[model samples]
Target: MNKKVLLVPLAAMTLSLVGCGEPDVDYTDNTRLTMRVHVDEGSEEGNGYKEIITAFNRENNGKIRVDLEFVARSGGIYETQLDNDKRKNTLPDLFTFDAPKCAYYAKNGYLYDLSSSFSTTEQDNFVALNRYQSKLFGIPIQESSAGFYYNKDMFNRAGIDVSGITVDNPWTFSQFKEACAKLKALPGLKGAVDMRLDATADETATYLLYPFIYSCGGSFVDSTGLHALNYFNSANSKKGFQFLKDLLDNGYTGTNYGAQDFFTHQVGMYLSSGWTIPELDNHVKWGQYFPDRNSWGLLPYPKADDGTAVSCNGSWSYAIGNNPRTDKSNVVTLLKYITNAKSSKVITQHTGMIPANKEAQVGYANPGSAEDVLLQQLNKTSVQRPETVGYAQFSSAFGRAIKYLKDYGVDKSVDDAAQYLEKELSRLK
Candidate 1:
């Protein structure tokens, strides 16, 4: 037998003896809840999830105790664990999942229907965008916006003006390309942009191509089924793909670069989320490369000719495990405690992510913090990723088009890519 299993009976005896001396709060009398946090162990934001759990524990006193489980960053592994837990009927009382994955769980009946649990008053407390995006799946605990974080010093050295840029006044896609061209022409900065295109990392597809698809008014799904493949083959998608291909073809982006790698080299500009700010702050010594700390600034994603400034917003949601023994009422109570407005603010404050609740945003205003500025800018112009079932498969299909474009350039035939995407999308239905 495992040594840990052998010690369990002794551990139970010790707990009994310890219980005799302490006042036992009958949390079970009301609702004994166990919360399991599904987190990516390697991420700094993962630590923030633990901090939020710690804050929740301290505030709950003895009324509730949560158990946290850290998961590997791989989405496939995370899904596998969830599947196993569901089969064994050992689902956690509560858990966290990415927005798109949560949508799949909600659609498949694997997660509770949170739409009924939130009151009108509570629902109204969240940002309008978040309310509209995540209403049915799970409460959003944190939010981050996708955009370009550029080094102003690099821009100035390249004779590119930063004065007219604002969150509300972001450049058009054409203008963004022009600026990048100028930056690339600079003496030392060979690669002026970081458009993540690696197939191995999901961010290339999620943070890069997803927004482009949206900006072009194309989508990964239609009434019939997943349409990402068809969408990418469409004339509009082809144009968008060609634009990105042109960038890579012209040597505007770094060689062998993904999002993380590009930023690590202090590349001219990077397209990523506000959540990256904290990591950059810790990793890059600002004074070493740039003259001003304020040299790094974020802007909304550039628009297409139609003037739609598109951006992708991703967030985490609290979920209930499929465990049969968990009391429904207890689970609801636990969800309430963890996703409350104050708790949401604590998460935002610590993690540099936007609070899911609109009321929680009030805490960030007037703070003059970089995160606050990013959140404020993002709120005005952002859209959530498609929260439908089979989103993973859909996103994967979409990624293929990106890879093709990045590797072969726009000169390659779109017909093959389109046919493959359509075939893959057919499976989602």
Candidate 2:
């Protein structure tokens, strides 16, 4: 439970920002700080954070203590709580936030400038850190990569072989459709794939599905992170979205599938991230279905027509609040403890996410393991979503556009979802 030696170098750093005005909290007290995280108190992810905090407290003993707050993510409750806190000026000394929100939070002054907490060399150690306006704001808790999960049994029944498919050598868009076709023809299957369209209400749509756009060399925003015109509505971007539309049009996937359809054996393939592995394991342990460890396999995202294999990356990260009066040294001490290589491994162990710290990734995955495959994607093909102050708007808008495609297919004149996406992003400025 002891922290790694990584904290020694970072602990000496100080917050460079001056207080905005009169401090809300007692600047004299730096020992007792509060931190909020988005997870149910009893969930695995929540327990992981608790374990880290407990160890941190035990190590610090009486010198420093962290009061933990659990803000459940269900129904956008976590984000809503943070919004309420921001309005009330009661934000915690430290908090965990989604990576995509880094821009919006930094732009709105919700996070502290963490450039000092992590040195350039240290920052380079994490797979992805949240930065805005050329300043570091948040440290990634873990790196993320998404892939297709195919039922091994179903694949075998369809006489299909996926042993050659890998993160570097993935199926082409057409090959993916062909595989779905083969799977659909099999008897007693709900559908060929579960695209997770049911999860469109929140960030999942944008986080998980954006690869479809990027694989075809599309982008949600330009390099400046301030525009989403031709970048989002280009012919290449349209081709990416068109692939999704074709899935629905061809009856390869549909809107009616439940989120757990894959686990329940209702689908041949499910598009998801590393977290799905734990879900499948839990379901098997609970006797929900009798599938052994080899019953399913992970796949890299399909390649675009241009032979590009792009996958999603980025996850929740720890960020100090904007309160300049708080004891930055104490808060950052805990932040380094929570995000250090050892902490990264512990958290990823429970959550099934890849460790963000490069050191943690070392010896973490076995050769040819599922985690290895995901690690390869994160290292080689994964891309973070567009960093923009308008990301929240873009996430919601993109999710809605995908839903629009689901609600109204190509035949209904909704095939131009990219155009709709472009139009929505156009209003961001």
Candidate 3:
């Protein structure tokens, strides 16, 4: 039997060199690497990642071994844990993080450069959005987008036509507001849920909610990336904020999310990724709305006043940690295997997320499905989260400011919130 191994959390290089050419034990294992993965347990992506790890280990047996650490998808707590790990230098050899955090982590000197190692043409095979300021700090394993999941039963009962809420013909801000108003009129139904307002939705405001601003022809930050004062507090931005305020202030959206949420028809709409979809195999047997599959649908983000389509895009990707001890060759090997066309196909099949590799994108499973709709939205209307060093602080402050509005009411104007956000940003700068 192989000798017992003591896993060093993130030290791939140091641990790999323990013996003359292998571990001191008779095991003769050449390389051992630790990996940390963050995706909800039982989630499609989580299951896909686990499968990938298993196959990788089986193939690399006796050559390289991996110590896998799985973490849940709680944005607030998970990021905090990662930060603590970084400070204590106890992070795994590599870990998964949302691509939006690329700038923040890279700027703070906490990642390996993957872009520089790839050939120009080879780089073309991967998703174009992984680079952070020209340097590839991470590789996107999958992709998701901003969209709406509405209750068809609620629509039918409210006598609202759900046709307009499609990718080709998205809901306008006014129409969306009107629909929410109608949804509230239904008996025993609460309203909608703009999940970004959830307290634990730390990075969500930056991803899910920003589309509201973008969909309204409003700018959140200037080209200089140093200001949100005029951009966020401006007249155009107010139009979006006011629309959101109306959703809550007028009782078109519920404050809390529960089991009785969207699926139960308690809330008419849920704004999130396709990952929220349940197993379609059971759809025919039972469900409130979308029982026929064609009954329910996904829609693009509401268009801006000028009819400009917009959406939020990105997902958890793999990045090498900045710890001093790293097995560069082994790490690169693992990354390449996981990101290539073959692996991408395998992963997308399990995660049901869009593929990050260009070739695999074409082969992504379940075309013309809810997940496909999300992929299409990403292609048509999506925008990447800002690759700025201040993104973390920016998201935090913005989330709090929006939560204040969501918690209070319309009285908490976007103008005041913008001012408060500007002040918070200055401290971070």
Candidate 4:
């Protein structure tokens, strides 16, 4: 995509007024509620949520109006907005949040208790890992998993097999490393893989380090209040850190490729969200030179030596704010409408994101649909990221550790790093 055209944040442009006007007079009297929904600018144009909103308005006759605000991809900007809103006690009626941050919001009592509102049947519609307790904080909107996306043509040129293996049967960590080495050794082939070690990439921490931590059975923040820095220095975490460092040391990765650049240039394998596949397929140039039309393939993160498969799932949820409503019933009705099965189908179809509702998943898995193959692959494997209030701090600490390991190499002593990690982990308590 053109950076100048595509780089524009959805929020930067106001919603076109054509054909959309304020609710008519009588419709407003039934129950007037203004909800601010945070959405990604990328999804703003053909977002599934728009269908849900439209269905909701039709059903309710415009009693509830949802105002969506597209947030930039910048973490700092989003955090600042949330913090400023929280301090002013002026937050949106509904917003979307992912793991770690969701845990933080729930822990701080910033969201409404949604457990009673949804049924066991409704909750069961979501994958087990996607659901959370603690006052039933938020409703899972779209769930996503992270993994390696390899160039089939590149793999074939190097004579590497790219068949049958999926998120469930991904290569072992060692196998993954070897694959990278083989690719790197191939004459005239591009680099083996692009692991995001660069500080500038937003996802360096979230997508890259978390899987390593999970693979080693290390928690970002332990119950006793340990953080990433503390986890990094531990013996178990040392293995995970070494795994990443070794990749960098062995020439499998470098600072050149973040998540976005990996697939775009067809450079070695890339680690990223499943939603990225559709966007990647749309961008790549294809022909005789690019023999692999289905040039991309998905696999879960490599397994640990003990054979445990782990991958992180990112879920954006619906949360209600503390605003008092004259007609609370209307608010609940709106919530149900937005999260209903029909809305979920639209979301899954358009965005390629896994639906939070079981019924909606069927739509993606219908015969002949590319999504069907991906859904079947993801369902058997994939897990939600650790949900904890100190996830942000944990992520930051882990990112720093990754950078340190990449720069210093695996041979570096863990003493200083471990000590630094332990101190940061203690702050979560």
lDDT for model 4, please. 0.62
lDDT, candidate 1, residue 348? 72
Q: By TM-score, who's the top model here?
A: 2
Q: CA lDDT of each candidate?
A: 0.65, 0.81, 0.70, 0.62
Steric clashes per prediction: 3, 0, 1, 6
Cα lDDT over the full model 2: 0.81
Compared with the true structure, what per-residue lDDT tens digits does model 4 show for residues 1-429? 787876465434445543355323222242555454455656642366666776677777745655556665464676577666666566556666664466678666567667777778877776642334545767767666666777776787777775656555667888888788878977653468766567523554566556775677655445534444445566666777778777877778776564455545546687666665666656444333334536566655787776466666556677776443333566667767767778877776776788866677765655423454456545665555655566665566555566667557643544455565567556656
Candidate 1: global Cα-lDDT? Answer: 0.65
TM-score of each: 0.80, 0.85, 0.77, 0.79
Q: For candidate 3, what is the lDDT?
A: 0.70
Worst 10-residue stretch by lDDT in candidate 4?
A: 21-30
Q: Per-residue lDDT tens digits of candidate 2, residues 1-429?
A: 447566654554433233334346554588888899999899999999999999999999999988899988888888887887787677788999989889989988899999987778888888778889889999999888878888888899998888888887888998999999999999888889999776777777778888988888877777666666666666677677789988988889988898778877888998888877777777445244535667778888888868489888998999998764555888888888898899999998888789999999999888787778899889888888888887866777677667877566522322344455456556665
Put down candidate 1 lDDT per residue, 1-429, tens digits, no spaces: 799998999999999998856333233344455565555655665676677777777777787666667876464787787776676555666777777676567655567666777787876676532222345557777777766778777777878886676666767878888888888887765487877766424644565557775677765555434554555566676666666777787788744665454344446788776756765675355445443447576666777766476777766777665455434776777777667778777777767778877777776754444565567655776776665566666566556666666556653545555566567656666
Sorted by TM-score (best first), the order is: 2, 1, 4, 3
Which has the higher lDDT value, candidate number 1 or candidate number 2?
Answer: 2
Pairs with backbone N, CA or C atoms under 3 Å apart (clashes), candidate 4: 226-425, 227-425, 229-421, 230-421, 230-422, 233-418
Per-residue CA lDDT of model 3 for 284-326, tens digit only, reads 5345454766666666688755657778778878888776564
Q: Best candidate per lDDT, number? A: 2
Off by over 4 Å in 1: 1-30, 40-65, 72-77, 128-135, 223-225, 258-266, 283-286, 322-327, 365-373, 407-418
> Which 10-residue window of candidate 1 scores lowest in summed lDDT?
22-31
